[model samples]
Target: FPSAEHGLSADTEEQLRMRGCELIQAAGILLRLPQVAMATGQILFQRFYYCKSFVRHCAEMVAMACVHLASKIEEEPRRVRDVLNVFYHLKHSKGKRTQVPMPLDASYISAKAQVIKTERRVLKELGFCVHVKHPHKIIVMYLQVLECEKNTKLVQTAWNYMNDSLRTDVFLRFSAETVACACIYLSARTLQIPLPDQPPWFLLFGASEEDLREICGRILRLYSLPNVSLPSMLKEVDQCHLALDARIAKAKLAGGGLLAVGTPTLDVPSSFSPASKAGETGAHHSPIGNTLCNKNSVHVSFQKKVWKKHCSLLCFIWTPFWVSALRLTSLSVFRRSRSVSSPLRSVSPTHRQKISRRDREREKERERRRERERERGRGRRDEYSRRR
Candidate 1:
């Protein structure tokens, strides 16, 4: 079948192509391509399956293009020419080439143009399934809960660990929800903590319990594997990427929905505030029994007259009449006290002028002393120079 090519099986070449597509999709993430590109690739793989056509090109290039289109749609669009030229160089370079024959003629501009056309086809094939649910978001939520008593660095280490779990075929077998739950489960165990309850966010994907457990086990194995560094695991992922990407892309594009046909839409959590706690009434609690009390009734009503009449004398003293008068009187008293208490203000103008004149004379005397000192220094320097 390696030589045979172009057909279906229990494990078909087409299935392999789809697998290649998923790896490519994952690599696109490392390549810093937009998420839409993965979506685009997914759509393209399904379309390619329906057509059963095999072009003698780098599967990575096509997957990249699919991703590029998705990026464009998602507004994370790469420069079409850049995508083309980079892949073109990669295709022509034998050491880096993904397949037997590479398509160097697939220049950046040409690829861009091709993607533009492919985008429409992809959109049609996917039935315009534009929104994507990423595990990265779920990973963030899991980290927030897991790190409740820890710093961000601990959570970050766990998140970094979980990213490797994503590269495996587990995502294909499980929904993003289940995969996210597994990541959380593994992250908690890695930190040597009790596995946190799957946050409400995981329920958004509606994964079955059995599937989620399987996903969790695979993630745990990833944690236990010796000498399997994240970078190396990622590189291996890169090697088999095109096939993985193809599988994922095929599934996505074949979609009635991402997981199942007409799956109920999951409500996205608005934000993680104290107010977002389960069944809590907003940020502040209502005053005691106020929820049941009548607004217009005397007992619960917040009336000004009730406070004015019954409140402490301190409250009456704080009334506007007393407050304003007291303020004005305080200002008058402050002015009068200032006038009386200030010796400088009470002093006659003539006497004050005399003090100022004496201060000026003293300042002049100091300046004269400084000038005399400078002259003496100069004279001493001149005497020393003559002696030398």
Candidate 2:
């Protein structure tokens, strides 16, 4: 979805999405998350990229953020520390070098902060509509409808197709039901099983043959594509960013570094909401994305406190947005270094209730009962002393 203004070709954006979705799936497994949560995270990741480009952001960070956000949205909450730990382990487990993982030090704290910030960014871009409609369950339901539910192989194949489709824009372009139908259609054909074609089984599910074909094509196309490596992908995106930066510098030199002044800056305040419109786009339009930044400058949080001049988005006016977003107050973050903490979230804190007058009087009566008991013991001790 990278427009011509984004300067990256559609293929590059697609690769970023594919790799990000793969990361979400892998992270979900390491975090022991359910398939639905993983799918939801993948959908959120894609929805984000539909508005943001790879050039302006880090794919790995966004992938982790989506997983973190989705887990909570799905009611299976994992703490920021646990999410970061799992992601860190997975990241290091891939290499031959035995790198001792960074302890829960300043570096980890920075990464944790980055995860929270990135998660907020994703939510903001999406207008906080993180609900994901997955087709995996629908595949089983449809299989049962066609009396093929008992066919384990076919069912598994369709389910796999649905999962794979998460790496593509088919979910964004079509309904979950349509994608489910396409998955079943592809699976039936692959397994050499005949479905009811007289009325076309998909028709019963409200999907046209054309919709099935389009979706199936996307599913099949995913397998044909080569796997994307995270490191290589990062390098590629970095190269694009470098090229973008160079172009911006050249333009600034040509325009005496004043071309970006009148490009219409966005007032992305801390209270920025969907109603706070940016540019000419609608209220629900992606705020810090296509309209805000034209690739002049990006302010991203990097681990080890390494900041990259990752943007040359002249029209974006991203500094103020980053400032407001970063100035957010988090009590948990403040207390992070002051105390030991668990990685996974426990029960939410309960509020202190006001005590009733009766309950308070009962509490006072119990105290008086203890006072009488002490007085009796003192009296007995005094008598014993007299006898001695």
Candidate 3:
């Protein structure tokens, strides 16, 4: 799709993708699909949208299609009707009608059709590459290899992190093994579980420290908690204001004692008031006569001069062309008016008579030429008869 057709900025598109991920998780729960199936469906949804725009496609329909396709790909086939029924049930439960029975109504039929149509589109967008190797299984396997399988807390937390990671584009950006290692490492750190740091555990999974750090940072930012110390934050804000004032003062000094035009002047005490000094300075530097209020008057005057010069130049270049065009148009209009008023006004009576006489003479000359040609042909035929 063209960039304009996406109908979303970068930030908005990311937010939409995050919302889609949440819906995918919710739909998976509603349908009671396994964890792997849910993860697969989320991956498929993200991949499809990487090449498609959310504005042109309905998110709910695409999410439903992803779940449906995931069921089949994961070898746990669920009918389209069942999936759509679950969606409709969840949708109505939040509204006034909580006990609406699923029927073969128009809405239900239309939803089913949409799901099927979006399912094919999703598959085509993915290039039929529906098989996604998730980091969940890899995390479990690695936990076992590290002999940390018995730590249920660590394993469970890492598993949750892996699920959360699907909401991001990390799946498309990084390899499964790298993501798996990062999640496991983060889980261990969160739980304060010790690991052998001599060789760094991530190296075993072929993940660089920088990649792991980037992944962990993204996960942290996703789950960022509110600051608990509000007083410290306020103090930092005050310090920032003071520093900004200092920098502004320094800039004024560096620029030959000329303050920024819009800056508010500082008040002075009566004993050491420099009002006269300020007035003198203003008289010397102000753009208008002895007034500081018209600081922008200089710019306005310069702009007026530039505009006048530009207009003059344009008139110089285009005046003759416009005048000639207007003259030609007026002449054509006058001719048209004369013709409309009286066609004979276009030519004098004498000129008309001369034109008619020339035409008659030309016609007679043409007739004489044709007669001579016919007589010559007859003479040729007579000579041929005599020879025979």
Ranking by TM-score: 2, 3, 1
Model 1 lDDT tens row, 1-388: 2212322232333334544455556646655865545644564554443433332233454465566666666667676655555554444554554544434564545766766676565566557765545576776766565454355655675566445554345655566667776666556566776543456434544656677678777655544534422233334435444554565566555542342222333444345455356226622356543534344356535576667667767676679788889999998877666556755553456566777999999999999999999999999999999999
* Candidate that scores best on TM-score: 2
Which number leads on lDDT?
A: 2
Q: Please state the error at residue 8 of candidate 3 in Å.
A: 0.6
Q: Give residue 350's lDDT in candidate 1 (0 to 100).
A: 59
True lDDT of residue 354, candidate 2:
27
Worst 10-residue stretch by lDDT in candidate 1? 1-10
Q: Indicate whether candidate 1 or candidate 2 has the larger TM-score.
A: 2
Model 2, range 258-330, lDDT digits (tens) per residue?
3232243233445556545444354245655654454433433342234223344532578777766666645
Assess each prediction's global lDDT (C-alpha) against the native. 0.55, 0.78, 0.77
For each of the candidates, the C-alpha root-mean-square deviation to the true structure, in angstroms, is: 21.7, 19.6, 18.8
For residues 1-388, write the lDDT of model 3, one tens digit per residue: 2212323455555555676777778878888889888889888988987787654566678888998999899888789988887776765676476477688989887889889999999988778888788778799899998999999999999988888988887898899999999999899999999987999888888999899888888777666634223233334434544554565677565553333323444544344557567657665665574544465667789899999999999999999999999999998888666655656663556556777899999999999999999999999999999999
Colliding pairs, model 2:
292-316, 293-316, 294-313, 295-312, 295-313, 296-312, 296-313, 296-314, 297-313
